[model samples]
Target: MSVLFDRIALIGIGLIGSSLAHDIRRLGLTKEIVVATRSADTLKRAEELGLGDRYTTSSAEAVKHADLIIVSVPVGASESVAKEIAGNLQPGAIVTDVGSTKASVIAQMQPHMPENVHFIPGHPLAGTEKSGPDAGFPGLFEGRWCIFTPVAETDETALKRLRGFWEALGSKVDEMDAEHHDKVLAIVSHLPHIIAYNIVGTADDLETVTESEVIKYSASGFRDFTRLAASDPTMWRDVCLHNRDAILEMLARFSEDLAYLQRAIRWGEGDKIFELFTRTRAIRRSIVQAGQDVDAPDFGRPHPLDKK
Candidate 1:
């Protein structure tokens, strides 16, 4: 494919940023990639990895002369990055982000964005539990969703160009208003990570029950939650804070459902328990049908015994 932009500035060289760099280079998405990060070590590491054509610790310097800018910082740092890069942004540059919390990102970064640039808030529903520049790989966005919550004053041509960029990365792009996007992600993404972290924390506190036993018999069920629990704490912390209201709403709903399950089990309501399980199992099948996950057993985890 032809280059989508003359220059693409990546304002944070974390997993998402590095992955974009890999794909942008592999797919020929841009003529140049300027990587930036707040941490000098991270900037140095990005340079060593050859993730971009240029690297700097200054976000403002990274945006200079860029045609497209992608901010991949924590949601809480959105405004800080925006403030730093505001004045240096080139006219008509398409600026977007890969933050999970759309509403908070918009609230933080939108006001600081210059009127001449196109600021589109976005969330790429793609990533693994891994973090850092080394964890990134090509094809991470393949078969995944990239949702955009465009503002009212957004330019149509700019939005289309941004959509085309994601499409070239193998992402299935979708658009929704910021409020609705936050609500949807609260239930689908935030709550699951919250639950995972909580479950792991509870297990840690169960010393009377024996932590050693929990680790020894992890194959029972507890092992699955650890993967989600192992996600970067900083990112999750920012997600909880930035998307608090929607997350709280989802948590309340989950609490009610848990209570209903507790009452059913206490009263030996086997039929009710079976019904809920049956209904929820269908959702898993639907996700696989939609190509979001594999149909293979153990969620397609590689085992030593599997044939190559």
Candidate 2:
């Protein structure tokens, strides 16, 4: 619980950055927290919320004496933020990111990082559908996974120190190569968001079904998709553009499986449908058993089945 860093600078005061600020202050992780964002209104709001000891609109100024710097911007803006802070970074600073796509973030930020600094690309697999500075709260990362895609030339001591910081925040930390991390996240995170957006869009485009009817009759399955679809659009757009290759690969595989299910339904193959459903149900059970999620229906919410 002692100070892990003398000063920690947060670039982009959105959900992740603000959440880190809350946890850092709550756990006494840093002597000072410098919060920076491009928007003046957001900077003012961060100050009002007391999320940091110092607030600035300039990223470079925020990191002038910061020992640890976390970039929480969208992946598309990673390069510009890196360029701005590259010249101002203190020697031996630990630079990390909370980007969803690791390879693209590394490609954009690594080149600009100074040789003395440790540029570790990381993704914390934790969030809600909400965003903005107000959406952040303490314990957001507790029991979640924080994966670091460290480069070959990364300093081992710096990496361990960064890991310790996340661990102190109650996160389980792991490391993987950038390419493999991208591939794994494409299916687990990217594809699911893409599917949710697509499904919601399709429902919206249904000419025969009135909007009110769709809302009134929405079942748990459709409601869950809406929750994922409600995530920050700018961040998801950047994720899609940055991780195009891996997402396309997963999309192709998803299409093939969808076609198989379509063929089975067309042929009235009840056994095939039942077999697939049974297998998928087991996967859900495994997730619950692994402590990743609760076994309660509707993600631990009240379901129609519980009404009676």
Best by lDDT: 2
The estimated TM-scores of all candidates read: 0.97, 0.97
Candidate 2 TM-score to native: 0.97
lDDT of 1 by residue, 1-308 (tens): 89989999999888899999999999999999999998999888998999999988899999999999999998999999999999999999999999999989999999999899999999999999999999899998987899999999999999999999999999999999999999999999999999999999999998588989999999888999999999989999999999999999999999999999999999999999999999999999998998778899898778887766
Q: Model 1, poorest ten-residue lDDT window?
A: 299-308
For candidate 1, list the clashing residue pairs, or say none: none
For candidate 1, what is the total of clashing residue pairs? 0
Candidate 1 lDDT at 17 equals: 94
Q: List, residue by residue over 159-265, the lDDT tens digit for candidate 2.
A: 99999999999999988998999999999999999999999999999999987788888874688899999999999999999999999999999999999999999
**What's the residue-level lDDT of 36 in candidate 2?**
98
Q: Runs in model 2 with CA error above 4 Å?
A: 303-308
